[model samples]
Target chain A: MAGNREFANRRLHSLLGVIPLGIFVIQHLVVNHYATNGVESFNKAANFMGGLPFRIFLETFIIFLPLAYHAIYGIYIAFTAKNNVGRYSYFRNWMFMLQRLTGIITLIFVAWHLWETRIAAARGSDVNFDMMSNILDNPFMVAFYIIGIVSTTFHFANGLWSFAVTWGLTISPRAQRITTYVTMVIFVALSYVGISAILAFV
Target chain B: MAENKNVRFIITRQDNPDSAPYQVEFVLPYRPNMNVISALMEIRRNPVQANGDKTAPITWDMNCLEEVCGACSMVINGKPRQACTALVDQLEQPIRLEPMRTFPVIRDLQVDRSRMFDSLKKVKAWIPIDGTYDLGPGPRMPERKRQWAYELSKCMTCGVCLEACPNVNSSSDYIGPQPLSQVRLFNAHPTGAMNAPERLNAIMGDGGIASCGMSQNCVQSCPKGIPLTTSIAALNRDTTIQSFRNFFGSDR
Candidate 1:
C-alpha cells in the first residue's frame, strides 16, 4: 500500500510537470514569433510585456517553478521506472528519452535565456530586439534558436499528445493514431513558422 | 541446407551516446547454431567488417542470456526480440540489425529506458509492502487469482509493449501496457487489494489504462506471454466501477 502510493505520487508529479510546462512552452513560442517582425517591432512586444504591472513578480515565480516541478519530479519518476518488460519499438523509446533530455535542455536554455534577457534588462542592459537581432544574426545563436524551437515544439506538442494518454483521453488504437498525427501536424506547423522566421532573418 | 559460406550482417554502430552512428557490414563464417547475440559477441571480439578493415567494437545491452532478462531485446529483421533467443538457423541471411528506433540509441543497441520505468511509477504498479515490523503472514491469494496474477507479475520491463504501442512514441505521455498489467496484478491481491481503488483511479486518470491503444500487440509480443489485453480489459471494468464510485462519492 505504501509503495503503491509513492509510485502514484510520482505519476502525479509527472502529470504536473507536463501541464504548466506544456502551456508555458506554447505561450512562450507565440511571444517569440514576434521576433519575425524585426528589432524595433520585436522589442515593442518585449517592452510592452515589461510594461505590464506586476509582470516581474509573475515572471519571477513562473521562471523557476515549471522546470523545477518538471525536472526534479521527472527524475524521481524516471529513477523508479521499470524497463524492458515488453517489446518496445524504436519510435516509442526514442520519444521517451528525448522528452526527458529535451526537458533538461529546455531548462538550461530557459535559464540562459533569462540571464540574457530578463536578468540583463533588470540590470539596465537588457538585450532587446536590436541586440536580439544582432545576436540572432550570428550563426551560433541562430543554430541554437532553430534547434531550441524545434525541440521546444517537439517538447510541447509531444507533451500534449502524451498528455492525452496521461490524462486518459486517447484510449483506443484509433485515438492513439489520431493523437499521433495531430501532434505531428502541430510540430510540422510550428516548424514551418519557426524555421521560416529564422531563415528570413538569415 | 549446407552452411552457406555467404551470409551477411549489416549492423549499426556507435562508440557511445555522444558519438555519431554509422553502419558496418560483416560476412560471418556461417557457423551452424549461432544466434544474433553470439554473432554480436563474435563481432565484438573480432572488430572487423566485410572489407576486412579494422573497426570499433559495436556496443549493445544484454543481461541474462536467457530470454528471462529481456535486456537483450532489439529489432531482428523487423521484430523486436531478445538477441539471446534470436537464432541464426531460423533467421534469413544478410540479417539487418538496427537499434530499436523507438529508443534513443545510447551507444548502439542500448536505449535509455527511463521512460518505461517512469510510466510504471506513474501507475503505482507495485504491491505496497513495507517491512519494518514482524507482522504475521500476509493474506493468501487464491490459486485461481494467483495463476493469472503470476503472469501479470512477470513483467520484466522489457518495453516491447511500449514499442508496439502506437500511443507511446517520443512525443506522447502514454505509459503503455506493461505498467497497466502491473496495476491489475497489485489491485487483485488481498492486502494489495486495499489500494485497488487508488490504483484503478490512477490508471483511470492521466496516463492511466485509458491511454492504452488496445492494439493487442502487448499480448502477442510479451515474451512471457502475459495476458496483457485481458488485464487491460479487466482494468476497463475496474476503472468503470471506480468512476461510478467517484460519481456516487464512494470511491474509497
Candidate 2:
C-alpha cells in the first residue's frame, strides 16, 4: 500500500504533463500560427477562442488545475530531490536536472505570459496584432519571449517522451528511442511555429 | 585537570518509528585505533550527554564489525557509509550520525532495509536449482565473466545507493541500484539465465529501471564500487530485448 502511494503519485505527475498541458501547448501553437495570415485573421482566431462558451469554467478546470498540481508538486520534488549531475554528468542525469530547471522557468514564464495576455484580454484590453507587436517590439521582451517559448517547447517535447514511458506506452529501448526521435521532431516543429509567430509580430 | 582527548558525536535519535527524531551530543574518550562503531559502543555504555545530562542510549544495528555486513550503514557527517568502517582518525570532529532515510527508520540509527530485500525478491535475484537428484556441477563461467560477476555479487544489500538516489525518495517507488545490479549478476549465470526473462520483465515497470533518474550517485555511493549505473544501462538493453520477445512470442 505504501509502495502504491509512491507509484500512484509518480503516475499522476506524469499523466498531468501530457493530458491537458501537452494538449494545450499544441493547441496554443496552432492558434498562434494564425498570425502568419494577417493581424485581422489572428485577432479573429483569438477572439473566437476567447468567445467560446464556458470559457472561464473550461480554462479553470482543464488548464489551471493541472498546471497548479504539476507546478506545485514539481517544486516539492525539486526541493526534496538531489542533483548529482556535477559529479556523474551522464546524459540522462543532465536531462533529469534540466527537466526540473526548465519546469521552474516555464512555470514563471507561463504565469507572467498568461497574466500579460489572457488577463489583459479578459479585462477588456485590446488583444490584437498591434498589442502583440508592440509587446515584442522591445528587444528585451522579444528575447524573454524567445527564451520562454523555447523552454516551453522543450518541456512539452521531453514531457511527451517521459509520459509514454510512465504510462507503459513505450516499454522497450527501441520504442523509447523511436519515441525520442518522434518527440524531437515535435520539438522542432513546435519551435518553428513559436518562432514564426514571434517573427510575424516583428 | 588532566588533558582529555575525546571525540564529539552529534547523533539523530528517535524513540520509535512514530516519534519525531532529535539530535543529542556525546563526547567519548578518544581511543586509539577506534572506528565510529567503537565510539557508538562507548556512548551506549555510558548513555550520557555532553551537557552532563543522562539520556537514553543511542541505538543502531551492527554485525561482523567489518564492512561486510553492511548493517551499520548511516549518514556520517552528511555522507552515507558503513559506520563500522568510519575511522575516527580519518574523520573530522563532531561526527554526525543519522539513519539512512531511504528506508523507514526503525529507531535512532537503525532503518528497515526490507525494501531492498523485497525488491530482490521482486526481481527473483537468484538461480533456481533442481532438488533431490545430485546434479552435476553447473556450467563454468569464463574467468573474465567471473571477475566482474564477483564484484556485483559483493553487494550486501546496503541501502546507501538508495539513499543517494534522487529517484528513490520517500515518495518514489524506484527499486534502486542494488537490486538492478544483482539482476545483471544473476542473469549472467548459466542456470540463472533460464529465469532472465522473468527478471527482465520485473524491472520493466513503474518502480523498475524506468524510475531511474540517472543521477549516477549509486555508482559513487556503493561501498563495493559496483558499476551500478552500468548494470542499469545493461538491464535497460536486456529489458528492451525482453519486451521484444514478449511482443513477437520469441525468446531470442
Candidate 3:
C-alpha cells in the first residue's frame, strides 16, 4: 500500500543518514585531519583511503548512491518543511528547523566539494595535500569551507537526535535530553576536526 | 502573587467563527483558591469589561469542572491546559486566555476539535463488538500491560497536544499525538488486536507517523501525562515490522 511505501522511504532516508553517510562524514574528516601532521601525511592518508581494494565499487555503492539518495530526498524534505521557529521557539523546534536548513546547505557544500575534489580527480588531478591547500588558498574559499564544515557537522549531529527518536532508540524525555548532550558533543568535536583540517590545508 | 484585590484577565475573544479575534480585559474580585474556570464563570455572570463597557457573555465549552473532560482546554498564560485545573494562584497575573489556535476558533476560548475526533475515527480507536449478541470472554492480558494501557486510555481527545505541536497547524494534516496514542491503547486490547494491522496501517501513511518531527511538545503539553512520545516510538517499531510484512506478503 501507499502507506507502507511512504514509511519505508522515510525510514530509508533516516537510516541512510546515519549509516554510511554519517559514518563517511566522520571518516572523511579524520582523513582530512591528517593535514595537521604535515602535507605528506595528509596525502598519505588520502592516498590510503583512495587506494583501497574495490575502491570504485565502494565509492559507487557505499558513498555515491546513498549520498545521491540522501541529498535528493533531503532537498524535498527541506523545501516542504514548514518551519515554525517563530511561534514555537522551543529547543527541539529550532533543531527541527535547523536540520532542514543545514541539510540544504550541506547538500550545496557537498556538491561543490565533490566538484573540486572527486570530479577533478576523475579528470586526472591528484587529490593530494596541495589540491586541498590550493582550494583553501583564498580567504573566501576558506570561509566557505568553514561554514560548510560547520553546517555539515550540525546536520549530522542534530540528525542523530532525530534518528534516535525515529528509530525508537530514545523514547523518554530523559533519554532524549541525554542524546541532545551527546550529539552536541559530536557537533563540537567534528566541527573542530573539520575546521582544523581546513586551516591546516591553508 | 500581587497584593491587588482583583485579578485581571486578558481574554482573546472572537465574536463568531469568521470574525477577527480581539483581546478584552476583565478585572474580577479575587476569590481564594479559584481556578480559571471559576474566573471565566464570574466574567460570564457580569458581562462588563475592565473599562466599564458592557459586552456579550464570554462563550466557552465546559462540562466537568475537573481536568477529565478536556472540554475546557485553552491557552492559559500561553500554555495549553484544562482551565479547570489552572489555579489562579499558580498562574501569574494577569491571566491570559486564548483559544487553541491549532483548530478553528469557534468563539472566545473555544475551538472546534473535530480534527482529533476525525483522527480517532480514522484510526478506529475502539474495539469492535456488538452488545446484541453474547460473545465469549476475551483473552487475558498481563497485569503489567493492562496497567500501562490504562495510562494510554486516559486520553480524553483533548486538543492540547495538537495545540502544542508546531506540525499540527492548519497547513499540515498530521493527526497529532492524541489519536496516535489511542492507536496504541486500542491495539493492546485482546479483541482490538484483531484490527491491529488496520490501525498500524492507518498511521504509516502521509500525515501519519512519518510526519511526526519528534518536537516532543506533545508529551510535555499532555495534561494526562500519557507518555505520548513512547507510544509514537513504539509505533515506529510497529510500523517498521508492518512494512516488512507488507513487503514479504505476510500481513497475516
Candidate 4:
C-alpha cells in the first residue's frame, strides 16, 4: 500500500505538470501578449479572465490548488535530492540541477510577481502601462525579470521533457531525442513571448 | 629509493556498525604496481597508524583481486569505484578510502550489499528455469540482441552505481541502477521474456525507475560501463507499454 502511494505520487507529479500548470503557462503567455497592445487592451483581456463565472472556485481548484501542490512538492524534491554535477559534469546532470535551481527561483519570482501585480490590482491598485513601464525602468529590475522569466520557462520546458520520460510517455531514444528538440522549441518560443511582454513594458 | 618512498592512505574507520566514523592515516613503504588493495593489505599487516598507535586491523571485503568481482568497491579519492582497479600510480598522494554509504556499513570499509541483492530478487532478475530433466532446446536469441544483453550481464552487484546515485539513500527506497539494468538483461533473454510482465510490474512500483533523478552519475562511476542510464530510458518505454497491456488486460 505504501509502495503504491509512492508510485502514484510520482505519476501524479508528472501528470499535474502538463495539465493545469503547463496549460496555465500557455494561457498565460497568450494572455500577456495583450500587453503589447497597451494597458487598456491588457486590462480587457485580464478582466475577462478575472470575471469568469465562479471565478473564485475555478482559481482555487485549477490555479491556486494545483499550483500550490506543484510548487510545494517541487520544493520538497529540490531539498531531498542531491546533485553530483561537479564530478560528473554531463549535460543532463547540469540540466537536472538547473531544473531544481530554477524551480526555487520561479517559486520566489512568481510569489513576488503575483503579489506586486495581480494581488495588488485586486486590492484596487491601478496596474496600467505607466506603472509597469516605470517598474521596468530600473536596469536591475529588468535584469531580474530576465533571469526570473527565463528560468521559469526553462524549468517548465525541461520539466515537461523529463515528466514524459518519468511517466513512460516517451520511451525510445529517438522519441526522447525528438521530445528534447520539441521542448527546446517550447522553451525558446515561450521565452520569446514572455520576454517580449517584459520588454514591451520597458 | 623504495625506503625513501611511502604510500599514504587516509582510510575512514568505524569500530562497529553503530560507531562513529573517523579517519586514520597510514604510511606504508612504497611498492611498484600497488593498487588500493595492496596498500590496504600492508595496513592490515602492520595494524598501525602513521602516528604509530596500534589499532584493530582494518576490515573490508575482496575476493578476486581483479575488478571483475566488484567486492572491493569503495569510494576512493571522493569517487565510488572498484579499489582493485584503482592503481596507486594513477592516484594522488594521501589517497582517501571510505565505505559506500548507500548500504549499511557492516564494519570499517565493508558494507552490507543485501539491499542490492534484495532488489534483484524483487525484480526477479533471473531466468526461472526450475524443475529437473533436460528440457528441449530453448528459443534462440538474435546475435544483435545477445550482444547488448551481454554488456548488461557484467553487473557484479558492486553497489558502485548505488553509491553514486543520490536518490538511493537511507531515507529513500529507490532501487538504484544495478537492478534496473538487470531487468533489461533478463527481459532480453529468449526464455526470460515469459516473465517480462512480472519484472516490468516490479519496476513500475515505488523505488522503481520513477525515482531516478537522472543525475547520470552511475554511468560514469560504473566499473563495467554498463550503460545504466540507457537501460533506464529503455525500461521507461517498456513499462509504458506494459501499463497499457495491463489496462487492456492483454500481455501482448
lDDT string, candidate 4, B93-156, tens digits: 8899999877789899999989888999999998988769877778999999999999999999
Q: List, residue by residue over B191-246, the lDDT tens digit for candidate 3.
A: 89888999999988777888787777787778999999899988877877777787
Ranking by TM-score: 4, 3, 2, 1
Q: Whole-model lDDT, candidate 1?
A: 0.70
Model 4 residue runs over 4 Å out of place are A1-3, A47-62, A118-144, A169-185, B132-135
Candidate 4 on A2-69: residue-level lDDT in tens?
44455556666777878888888889888888899888898788778877899888778877888888
Q: Chain B TM-score for each model?
A: 0.92, 0.96, 0.96, 0.97
True contacts kept of 3: 0.40
Candidate 2 lDDT by residue in tens digits, B1-252? 224888899999999999999999998887888999999889889899999999878889999888998899999988889999999999988899999977889999999999889999998998989789987798888899889889899999979988878788866667888999999999999889888988877877668876766556787688988878667767766765665577578835
| Alpha-carbon shift of residue A152 in model 4 (angstroms) | 0.9
Per-residue lDDT over A82-195 for candidate 1, one digit per residue giving the tens place of the 0 to 100 score = 333234444545565566656667666666767776677878886566656665778998888788778777877767666665544655556766887999899888777777
User: Model 2, retained fraction of real contacts?
Assistant: 0.20
Candidate 2 CAPRI category? incorrect
- Which candidate leads in DockQ? 4
Q: How many pairs of residues collide in model 4?
A: 0
Residue A22, model 1: lDDT of 60
lDDT by residue (tens digit), candidate 1, B69-151: 77878878767778899889898878978777677778878887777787777777777778788767788889998887887
Runs in model 1 deviating more than 4 A are A1-9, A38-40, A75-89, A196-202, B1-89, B92-182, B185-195, B198-251
Model 4: lDDT to the true structure: 0.85
